[model samples]
Target: MKILLVGAGLSGAVIGRDLAEAGHDITIVDSRPHIGGNCYTERDPETGVLVHVYGPHIFHTDDEEVWDYVNRYQTFRPYKNRVKTTSQGAVYSLPVNLHTINQFYGKTLRPAEAREFLEEQADSSIADPQTFEEQALRFVGPDLYAAFFKGYTEKQWGCSPTELPASILKRLPVRFNYDDNYFFHRFQGMPETGYTEMIAAILDHPAIEVRLDTRFSAEQGAGYDHVFYSGPLDGYFDYRLGRLGYRTLDFERFTDQGDYQGCAVMNYGDRDVPYTRITEHKHFAPWESHEGTVCYREYSRAAGPDDIPYYPIRLVAEKALLADYVALAEETAGVTFVGRLGTYRYLDMDVTIREALDAAAAFRASAAAGDAMPAFVKSPL
Candidate 1:
């Protein structure tokens, strides 16, 4: 079988690797000059610090299989994400824990007491919260929401919390204890060198050919037996239905001597601050040290035609547009849509790899049974 993968990101690389191992020829093409897509990492020429080229990507997952799969290619250094946010003229730990509650209110309340205090502060009137602001007020009340979430949410999503969906806030946590670790995943780590090198190792098979700085088109799918389209779903048909909404990020890079913020990620909860967060690239790999440090001030905005799309804005309007695209995708043949862009969802690194692995297995099973491959292994809606 000859497979043409549209993008050289995790979806293409993982699927291509699996198919190649199964005696299939795989050709991967990417418009970007690198293999890892948005997760690409490179060392700073001047500072010698390994930098996550496009914002920070912390690998954290509860799936043991995904953890083991990545470890096979590179050394997995144990890492935990401890995030801090500056809000209301002071700095505090994130997730709104006991320490944060105590610090903000000037009280030494314990875990249980803090929980009760937040409960008291919470609005009991809103029984079924639909908006992000209502949800926040119901859970943590207006004071904490205004201080920590309101400004930050407005900055990140470029909208008021009142306009956003309640589902968005569900991903966030309001911990009772002092646990500040960002994720609840069991396995959390980063590659020793960088994501690009690890991805390069995955595509090193003899049956797989990787072409960088090459853009793939729907017309090019004729040469191969099948096509794995990991690019944007709307892009395949030239966005005939309409372009789906996406939030793109812009990084403002700067240099500093020694440690800049003494942390990997520092969130600015104030909307007036302009940038959402400041990421110190050197702190991502704390095992390595350098005299000079590299950092990026991340800014979020609605994606334009030429901008790189970071997150799918699956609001009411975008959902309808995505449905039209999915219907069109289903009518098409010889191409399978996979990954974040294909499915029009914001996926974590582990979730993306897991889906890629599943898609590969499904394709192999379909081939063995002489069944037709699905346009989508997982539903976009």
Candidate 2:
């Protein structure tokens, strides 16, 4: 069978490799002249330090299988993500840990006392929170919410917290104890080489041919036995329905001597600050030493047609738009939509890989049994 994959990111690359190993002829196409998608990294010409071109993506997952699978491509170094936030004029540890609570309120309360204190601080009126603002106020109270989350959330989403869903804040941790690990995932590390090398290895199969700077069209997919799409879901249907809302990022890059932020990521929670966060690329690869460091000040804005969509803003209107696309996808034949953009959801690298693997396995099983291919292995909506 000849398979055509759109978007040579992790999802496309993984599925391509899997099908190719099964003796299927695979052709992968990506609009970008790159392999890793947003996870792409390259060495800085000036300092020779590895930089995440799009933004910082720390490979962290609880799935042992995922960790083992990625390790096959490159050696991974142990790296823990420790993030700090600047609110007003002071710096505080992120995820609202014990130190943050103490320093912010000017009190040395213990873990139990702090937890109780926060409960008291929280707005009891918001019993069943629906919006982001209500959730934040209910969880951390007005003062902390105003300082840390209110402005940052506004900048990141380009909307007031009241317009956003409560689920947005659910992922964030508000620990009473001093555990400041950003993610609770079991496996967390950075690839020793870079994400691009790992993706290159995945698409390095003899049966697979990768076409960079090429766009996959419906016309081009006719010759193939099956097509696996990892591009935008709305793009597949030619936007017959309205465009799904997405938050895109604009990165401001600059060179600096010595350390800039002294950390991998620094969040600017103050509303006065234009950008959401600043990422120090050198800190991401602590294994390598460079006198000069490069940093990116990230600004989030509404995604336009030409901009690269980073986060899917699944607000009420966008969800309705996505539903129409899903309906169209269901009616369509001979194609499977997989990955973040294809599914029209914000997916982490690990989840995207896992879903792609699942899709491949399901495809193989269907083919072996002489069954028709599933329209979607997992529902995007």
Candidate 3:
């Protein structure tokens, strides 16, 4: 079977690799000149530091199979994301742990004391929290929420925390202990050789043909037995209904002589601050030593037509538009939408790979059983 994969990102690459390995001919196309999509990383010419071209991407997953799968392509260096935030002229550990609580209040409180203190600070009047601001106030109190989350959330999402969903705050954990690890995933690491190399290795299989700088069209799908569209869902139909809302990032890059910030990611939680975070790319790959450092000051704003879509703002209005596109995709034949943009969801790197693997496996099984391939193996809605 000849398979057409439109997008050289993780989703298309992983799916293409799987189908190719199953003896199916695969051709992966991307509009960009590079293959790794937003996960692209390359070495800085002057600094000798490997820069995350897009931004910092830490590979962390509890799935052992996914861990092993990526490890096959590149070396996985043990990495833990310990984030910091600067709010109101003070720096604090992120995820609002015991240290952050103690520092913010200027008191040395134990885990139990900190927990009890937060409980007292929490507003007991609100029975059920609906918005992000309410959820934060319910969990961490006004002071903590104001200092750490309120300003940052406003800048990141381009709206007030009250307008955002409470579900967004649910993903952010408030801890009683001093542990500052941003993510709780069992396996946390970065590809030693960088994400681009890892993904390039995945697409290196013999049966797969990668076409960089190629813009694949819907009419091209007629030539292949199956078409995996990993581009933006609305993009397939050329945004016939409406363009989905997304927050795109603008990276203001700069170079420093020595270690900058002494950390990988330092988030600015002050509303006065223009950018959201500053990412020192060298700190991401700690195993390698570099004299100079490269950093990016990240600014988030509404995604435009020409900009690359980063985070999907799947608010009520956007979801309504997404439903229309999903219906169109389901009714359309010989096409299966996959990945973050295609599905219009905020998916982690691991989840993207896992779904692609599953999607490919389903295709192989269906082909053998003479069953029709699904419009989507995993539901976006």
Candidate 4:
């Protein structure tokens, strides 16, 4: 079977490799002259540091299979994400750990005391939280919420915490003990060589032909046996139904001698600050040493048609728009929408790869049984 994959990101590349290995002729196309999508990385000409072109993407997952699968391409160094946030003119550890609580409140409370203190801090009236603000208040109270989440959330989503759903904040972990690890995933590391090289290796199969700078069109994909789209879900239908809301970022790159923020990522949790966070690229791969460091101050704003959509703003209005796209996708045939943009959801690199693998396997199974492949592996809506 001849398979055409749209968007040569992790999702497209993984699916392309899987299908190619299974004796299917695969052709992968990406509008950008690169693979790996947002996880694209390249060496800085000036500093000799591997910079995350799109943004910093630390490969962390609990799935051993996913880790092993990626390790086949490049060696992954042990790098745990330790994020710092600047709130109210002070730096605090992220995930609201014990150290953060103690420092922020000027208390030397033990683990038990800290947990109990936070419980007291939580708003008792709001038993059932509705919005992001309510969720944060219910968990960490007004002070912590205002300090850490309010400004950052407002800036990142271009909306108030009251407007955003509570589900967005639910993933963020709050610990009693001082465990500053941003993610609780078992496998957490960065690719020793960088993400691009890993993706390049995945597409280095004989049966797979990757065409960067090539954009796959629905009319063009008609000849293929099946189409796996990883581009914007709205783009598939040419935005006939209104465009799904997305938050795109603008990176302001600058160089500094030695270290910049003393960490890889530093969130500016203040309304006054224009940017959401500053990422030091060199710190991501601590294995490498450089005299100078390059960093990007990320500013999040409404995703225009021209801008690269980073995070999908799944507010009430956008959810309705997404529902229309999902319905349109179901009506359309011979196309399977996968990955972040295809599903119009914010997905991590590991989840994207896992979903792509699953999508490919499902496609093969359906094809062999002469059954129709569903419009989505996971629904966008």
Which pairs of residues have clashing backbones in candidate 1? Answer: none
Off by over 4 Å in 4: none
Better structure of 1 and 4 per lDDT: 1
Clashing pairs in 4: none
Q: lDDT (0-100) at residue 333 of candidate 2?
A: 85
TM-score of every candidate relative to the true structure:
0.99, 0.99, 0.99, 0.99
In the range 27-112, model 1's lDDT, one tens digit per residue, is 99999888999889999999999999988999999999999999999998999898999887899998788889999999999888
- lDDT, each prediction: 0.93, 0.92, 0.93, 0.92
Q: How well is each residue in 95-185 modelled by candidate 2, as lDDT tens digits?
A: 8999999999999999999999999999999889999999999999999999999999999999899999999899899988889888889
RMSD of each: 0.7, 0.8, 0.7, 0.9
Worst 10 residues of 2 by lDDT: 372-381
- Which stretches in model 1 have alpha-carbon errors above 4 Å? none
- In candidate 3, where is summed lDDT lowest over 10 consecutive residues? 371-380
Residue 372, model 3: lDDT of 82
